[model samples]
Target: MGRIIAIANQKGGVGKTTTAINLSACLAEAGKKVLTIDLDPQGNTTSGLGIDKDELENTVYELMLDECSIKESMKKTDIENLTIIPANVNLAGAEIELLDVKEKEYVLKNSVDYIQDDFDFIIIDCPPSLNMLTINSMTTANTILVPIQCEYYALEGLSQLMHTIHLVQERLNPNLEMEGVVFTMYDARTNLSTQVVENVKNNLDTTIYQTIIPRNIRLAEAPSHGLPITLYDSKSAGAESYRDLAREVINRKDV
Candidate 1:
């Protein structure tokens, strides 16, 4: 079965989508069959992989609603060994639509179970909120990977997110686990960034990857161009760092 890793953080603007795109791409480049699932209604991950979300005939919205099968919703991306199930603005209403559904938390988990054997990994880009969508993602995932930006207030909402994870483990999925936390947009020249990293390491008691993603212009630019850092600027520091993170993820026994 494929390992489902949900790239999540209730706090927005923390490199969640960026990590989702590059990490999935680099893992595919390393010869693993990967599937990227866009659960965020913004469709950033869909467009980031160079797929136009609006133009899609089927999306994650339809799959979650049982309007279509998983195979019908899957879209092949530009990267080899990588495929994606895109999401668009229509998914914004999923929270309300799923409110009264029976077994609501397991909706996504049950959908993904049928396709688990077809890929090596499934990376879900969760919405940046502790809403039903995020709950569904956590309930479905085997592991959760959090990306913390190296800035002030980086740990602000982490306590709530961790608490939510604890609830999911106790009430929903007993097998759910945390993959690890990785720092992003790190500026080595700033003392604040250094402090944030040290504080997180000391307090979290979790695995923090050694590779820190620098605030690279290329990393920011790639999304607008609808390409991952690896395909847009493979020589850039951002690309190299994500590649290293991929190796770290692959080697980790818990992952």
Candidate 2:
């Protein structure tokens, strides 16, 4: 079975989608078959991966509502081994619509179950909220990867995130686990960044990746150009850090 990891943080602008796009791309570059699902209605992941989310006819919204098959929603990215099930603004309404569906929490898990065997890893980009879409993703995923920015208020809302995860494990998906935490937007010259890392390390009992994604213009620019950092600027620090993070993700062994 493939590992299903959801790149999630209830807080937005914390590099959640950035990690989702880059990590999946890097893993695919390493010759692993990877599938990414854009559960966020904003569809940044879809556009970040070079897909035209606005033009898509089939998306996760359709899949969630049983209007389309998973295969029908899957789209190939510029990256060879990476496939994505794109989503668009239409998915924004899924929250209210899901209330009427039977076994709604399992819709994502059930769709993913049939196709999990075809890939080595499945990555999900969740909306930056604790909504029904996130609930579906938590139920579908084997683990959750959180990205924390190295700035003030870094540790805020984390307790709630952890508590939500705990509830998911207890009530919805008992097999779910924390994949790890990754620090993003780090600046070596700033003591505040260093202090934030130390603060989180001292407080949280979770695995933290060593590769810190420094704030790079290349990373920010790549999404606008419809490419991943690896393709847009392979030699840049952002690309290298994501590659290192991918290796770490594949090598990590749970204790």
Candidate 3:
């Protein structure tokens, strides 16, 4: 069965979507079949993989409403082993539409039921806020991975996000686990970044990946060009860090 991992953080601009796009791409580059679901209505993951969100015929929104089969929504990305179930602004209304559905929280989980074994890994990019969409993702995910930015307010809102995860584990998905934390936007020149890392280590009782993603211009530029760092500039530091992170992610799971 494919391991379902949700890349989530209520805090924005922390490289949540960036990690989702690149990590999935790197995993595919490692010869693993990967399916990435864009749960965020913004659909950055979809576009990051070179899919035009506006032209999509089917999206996660349709899957949530039972308007289309999971296979029907899965679109091939430019990356060889990477597939995506794109989303759009239409998905913003899915929560309200799903209100009438029975056990709506499992909508995504149930949708993935038939396709669970089709890939080695299923990556989900969740919205920046905790809402029905996020709840649906957590219910489906085996683990939640948080991307914390190396900044002054790095620790802020994390407790609440953890609390929400705890509640989800308690009430909805007992088997759900924290996939631990990955630090993003690290600037080696700044002591503040290192301090934030140390502070988070001291405060949060979770596994912290040793692979730190640095603040790279190429990383920021790739998304705008609709290419992952790996494809846009494989030689860049951003691409190297994500590749390292991907190896770490897979090796950790192996152990």
Candidate 4:
């Protein structure tokens, strides 16, 4: 079965979507069949991969609320071997609607079950909240990839996130595991960034990924252009770092 990894952090601006988009692109470029599931209502992942959100007929919203099959919602992207289950604004209501529904926690997990064996990886870009949407993402995921910004408050909301993960492991998906933590927007020129890195390493049990994504204009520009950094500026530091992250993920999985 394919590994389902939820790129999650209850904190925004932590490079969650950036890691999801670029890493999925690099994995596809490396000849791995990858599927990206946009669980965030913001639809940033959908647009980042070059999929027009307004034009999407079926999305993760439909799959979750309307009981639509994940297969029908899957859209092929510009990158070969990369597919996406786009998320639109409609998903914003799922949080409230799923609250009292029976077996609501497993909706996303059940949707992905049918296609679990079709790809090497399923990366879900979770919403930046500990709401129902995030719970669904957690329930469906086999591992969680956390992206921590190299800043002062980077570790502030982490305790709450870990507590939620523990709850999910105990009540939802016991097999769920932590993949690793990635430091993003790292600036070596700043002592604070270096200190944040050491702090995260000293606190978390998970290994820190070696590939630290530097703050790059190219990475920020690619999202507005609706393209992954790999396709927009392959030679940029942002693109190369994501490619390295992909390799590191593969290598660690092999071990």
| Residue-level error in angstroms, candidate 2, position 172 | 0.6
Number of the candidate with higher lDDT, 2 or 3? 3
After superposition, candidate 3 runs with Cα above 4 Å error: none
* lDDT score at residue 47, model 1, on the 0-100 scale: 99
Candidate 3 structure quality by residue, lDDT tens digits, 1-255: 899999989999999999999999999999999999999999999999999999988999999999999999999998999999999999999989998999999999999989989999999999999999999999999999999999999999999999999999999999899898999999999999999999999999988999999999999999999999999999999999999999988887532
| Per-residue lDDT of model 4, residues 1-255, tens digit only | 888889999999999999999999999999999999999989999999999999988999888875677889999999999999999899899888888878999998887999999999999999999998899889999888999999999999999999999999999999888988999999989999999999999998886789899988999899999999999999999999999999998787632
Q: How much is 153 displaced in model 2, in angstroms? A: 0.4
Badly placed stretches (over 4 Å) of model 4 are: none
TM match of model 2 to true structure = 0.99
Q: Which ten residues in a row have the lowest lDDT in candidate 4?
A: 246-255
Put down candidate 2 lDDT per residue, 1-255, tens digits, no spaces: 889999989999999999999999999999999999999999999999999998988999999999999999899998999999999999999999999899999999999999999999999999999999999999999999999999999998889989999999999999999998999999899999999999999999999899899988899899998899999999999999999999999887671
lDDT by candidate, in order shown: 0.94, 0.94, 0.95, 0.92
Clash pairs of candidate 1? none
Candidate 1, poorest ten consecutive residues by summed lDDT:
246-255
Please identify which of the two predictions, 3 or 4, would achieve the higher TM-score against the true structure: 3
Residues 1-255, model 1: lDDT tens digits: 888999999999999999999999999999999999999999999999999998999999998888999999999998999999999999999999998899999998898999999999899999999998999999989999999999999999999999999999999998999999999999989999999999999989777888889999999999999999999999999999999999998888854
